[model samples]
Target: MISKAEAKHIWVLAEQKKGKVANVALEAIGLARKLASASSQEVWAVLLGQDVGGLAEGLIQSGADVVLVVEHPKLDTFRDDPYVDVLAHLAENHKPAVFLIGANSAGRSLAPRLATKLRAGLAADCVELSWDAGNLVAVRPMYGGNVLATVTCPEARPQMATLRPKASPRPVLDASRKGRVEKVDLGGLQIRDRVKLLESVETGGGEVKLEEADIIVSGGRGMGGPERFAVVKALADAFKGAMGASRAAVDAGWVPYAHQVGQTGKTVSPKVYIACGISGAIQHLAGMRSSEIIVAINKNPDAPIFKVATFGIAGDLFEVVPLLTEAVKKEMS
Candidate 1:
């Protein structure tokens, strides 16, 4: 068993697919950089995939001091069992002081299992992380994001946490930042495939993914019906942004569940979030309250959404959205 005293490096799991690294992975690396600096340790990024060594340079530019690349044919796709098997093996052998994972769909599934394997503690969906003395302190939202809980694992050799995407500023890529690349050999390790990935299908909705979007325009119950959602789309198109919908609009069948943004749906932290006709339910705010800029348009001046909005319009969205779209178009033109 690896002891706490032997742990030296702070590790971040740098997730990638088909040579394209996930934004959240870079964000985790950015967070890990800060913690590593505070604790006077090296920030090591562990990347797993087939033929992904070329992607290591990008992680280096994103603030990783070392990129540990583990390549295998079984890792070509993201299957829970194989991924967990490989990651757990690495954790056991290398013995990092801290392990940070992105709190996306894949990380959420992988973290708990990896923690169980290492017999360590895990903080899920953490929004903030810091080094408190020698222990890693993670802050996560609880009870529909109304409460922020602070967690720490003082005794665990490798403290682990799944950090939310867009919670931290993305590190600026610097080619001048020098880092080392190391290849991990997976010899004699029997990677188990308990679950077979039958097929992976893409669910297409819009050009920009909500999670990665810089700007988002969402509509809600005040849209009145499904056909009226065109107004919301027009505004999103004008801003070259992604389209989002409140649970009320989705439940009302105005849009697909994929576009729903709330505690029950996809969490988004866009640079600009424009809410039209959405009365800010705590569940809804829990998802997008972290957005840098929020614009709310509701006829009701007393709407809860206005409380969190950076800019609010108390008027009819049907009239207001089109005008805003035209104004944006004119500005862009």
Candidate 2:
């Protein structure tokens, strides 16, 4: 076992795609900054991509004390084997005290493999993170978001955890903040390029990320059919927010699975979450109950959703949603 003295800085894997950094990556940096301040440690942001050296400055402004940029042709796009091999190499060399990764699609796939490579303990999908006397305490939701269980890696050298998207505050950008940027070359590094990317498709039509949206309008089985999603989209567009759907809607083929919001889908903590025709099952609530304000519109007043909604309207969403949309448009105009 590696001693505590061997581990030094806190590392955040800055996830980027097509030259744009993800919000969750910045959020992880922000959380890392908080932890670093408490422990008197430096925060390192590791960026891996081809020709992504230019994006290093933005990461410094977001509060990284050091930025490690690893460029490679194979890393131009995300593939599991290559990413895992590179990250594991870095972690083995650096031996950071804590390693934080965003609990997104790519992160979920990458974290476990990297952790296994380093023989480190992993806490997945943690809603909160803190330092507990040289140990990293991760608070993760359990029993379908009804319980929060705290986990710690007391014996592990690098305490690794995956932070859930939108669960923490975004770092404020400050251009004046300066930091060190180092280029890590892929010298003699034989990466395992098992997965080949023949083509890339944009199935969601480049829609706004549900986790980053300030407001979200979601529908459930109560939306009736696929056609009724138009009402949900209208409200979402009116607010310039993203549209979401419950698992029932997605399972019924009323909408794409990308719009699903629930335990089995995506977790969202928007400023406002409007549920139309949703019955509010526990599974669905587990994903979005963290929204600042919840508005539920359903004919059933006794729906489990009303129990958590800030405001509840018991009526037909067809008639009510159209009126609500018109009212919002009128008010905005």
**Candidate 2 — worst ten consecutive residues by lDDT sum?**
200-209
TM-score of each: 0.96, 0.96
Runs of candidate 1 with Cα error greater than 4 angstroms are none
Query: Relative to the unseen true structure, what is the C-alpha lDDT of residue 79 in candidate 2, on a scale of 0 to 100?
Result: 80
lDDT of 2 by residue, 24-117 (tens): 9999999999999999999999999999999999999999999999999999888889999999888878889899999998999999998898
Task: Show pairs that collide, candidate 1.
Answer: none
Candidate 1 local lDDT, 1-333, one digit each (tens): 458889888999999966888899999998889888888999999999999999999999999999999999999877789999999999898899899999888899999999998888899999899888899999998887889999999888789999998889889999999999999999999999877778877786437888888999999999999999999999998998999999999999889999999999988889999999999999999889989999999999999999999999999999999999999999988
lDDT (Cα, 0-100) at 264 in candidate 2: 90
Query: Residue 208, candidate 1: how far off, in angstroms?
Result: 1.5
lDDT of 2 at 180: 100
